[model samples]
Target: MRLHPDIPPGPLHEKWDNCRFSNTLVNPANRRKYEIIVVGTGLAGASAAASLAELGYNVKSFCIQDSPRRAHSIAAQGGINAAKNYQNDSDSVFRLFYDTIKGGDFRSREANVYRLAQISNAIIDHCAAQGVPFAREYGGTLANRSFGGAQVSRTFYARGQTGQQLLLGAYSSLMRQVAAGKVTIYSRREMMDVVVVDGQARGIIVRNLLTGELERYSANAVVLATGGYGNAFYLSTNAMASNVTAAWRAHKRGAGFANPCFVQIHPTCIPVHGDYQSKLTLMSESLRNDGRVWVPKKTNDL
Candidate 1:
């Protein structure tokens, strides 16, 4: 199959608005008739599941973990960057977009990155409304900090547990949907394959981790927010359970894979000597932000 991003036609700033305006709205009343399957319960999956359920769609959310709260997103110890301009440091959507594009070595799609930048502030507001305890100033304004890559202090965080708090916010929304019967969550089940029907992804086949039984579930649509393949590198900062299977399966069944090499490596890490697959002990990302990363002058001195 061919891959076409179908980027919105317009200027970078107007493309997102045009795209949003052109999106065909699903009938809210008929939304309940559509069963949407969301694989992975991390921030991306959980937020999508919660939002779709809120829109009156029936959602089936699956995860490999016994508890949704335990997704690798919780292990994140840094802050999230937004173009809120809370610091009054001249941060803007375009600036954030440019910075991100430059950080990606100019390889990222400008339209997509621009859209992400435009929605950055809204993301912070939504998470805050969800009761994410972000660090704030003494005057009750949201706090900002300088993180890696960006010169401006646009990073908003809940101390060192930004990911944990954000995930909690998304999880709360998801649980509320589950309680209302709008969403059904399947935990401890790993998606073994994507089930496609009529050139469309309709469902998935999952393996029950506890029973070793294969189960097939079909949906009107499927979403795979199963995250990165960092664990395939053998030694990395990603959670141990994080694997490439779900994404690989999707790729095999007609999905576009982009920028697999765009992986983040925490600079402050121990040079552990062992098998190549052995996981390395990484220091907090926030730590290196406060100080410089020191390297040994000679080989094998770590």
Candidate 2:
């Protein structure tokens, strides 16, 4: 990979600030001409669509769910990770950046990871402003917890239903845009194919999941946020309807599918009783608090 001379080199902490001032901005007056089609109603897609609409873009959002709130994002048990360091646990953005890079086995781009850390704090503030009802302290600030491979207590949560609360926050903001008629919400519509009129994505072919009717939604740019391909494992934690079709089709057309073989299995899944089990219940990882696992060295010990 060749580095561009124009790009700034700095400690990860300063990279975003350097890039922000250096990046060119699209004029607000010209933003109205861009029509963006965002697929999926997860936090990323819904928030992007709503924010784009807020920025004066002609936005069209799609979700197979009858309501945006039903997207698989609502099923997240754990909380979203940020580098708030509210617990005085000696957390910092660089530690998070280092941990994430090490956790991903050094495969993730440093710049991208740094950018996520940069935006981590803002995401908390953004969610808070939307009245997300995050769990708070007696002083009425916010709560924090530890999660996964992190050494600090920077995870912001709303009970065990953090994803549900965050998704509701984004959904509420999306609905506000929909009510203003700035964004056109296409519910119960599953994108079947991306309509690439030229070398770039111009639109998409979507199926009305209810009536089986196919419709074409043309836009200046199409964004797909349909989520992971965990379904490839045959039996995983992903939603039953979730598939890689849209992203795979896009890959066939162009975009390279990165890290095609990453899997993370927690130890708390219920013991599979039989082959007929459709899904596994994810007991919160927090259960590691009380439960303990042990195995006898000798088979006869059982």
User: Which numbered prediction scores highest in TM-score against the true structure?
Assistant: 1
Distance (Å) between predicted and true CA of 161, model 1? 1.0
Which candidate number maximizes lDDT? 1
Give me candidate 1's TM-score against the actual structure: 0.95
- Model 1: per-residue Cα lDDT over 204-290, one tens digit each: 999999999999999999999887667888688787777789989988988887778888877777777776655777666767667
Q: How does each model score on TM-score?
A: 0.95, 0.90
Candidate 2 lDDT by residue in tens digits, 1-302:
23343435787678778888888998999998889999988988899999999999989999988988998888787777788888988888888888989988998778888788878999999999988888899999898877775768888888889889999999999999999888998999987788887578999899999999999989999989887777778577778866778788887777667667876565677667688987667766655633445557699885
Q: Judged by lDDT against the true structure, how good is candidate 1? A: 0.89
Give the distance in Å from residue 13's predicted Cα in candidate 1 to where it truly belongs: 0.6
- Positional deviation of 76 in candidate 2, in angstroms? 0.6
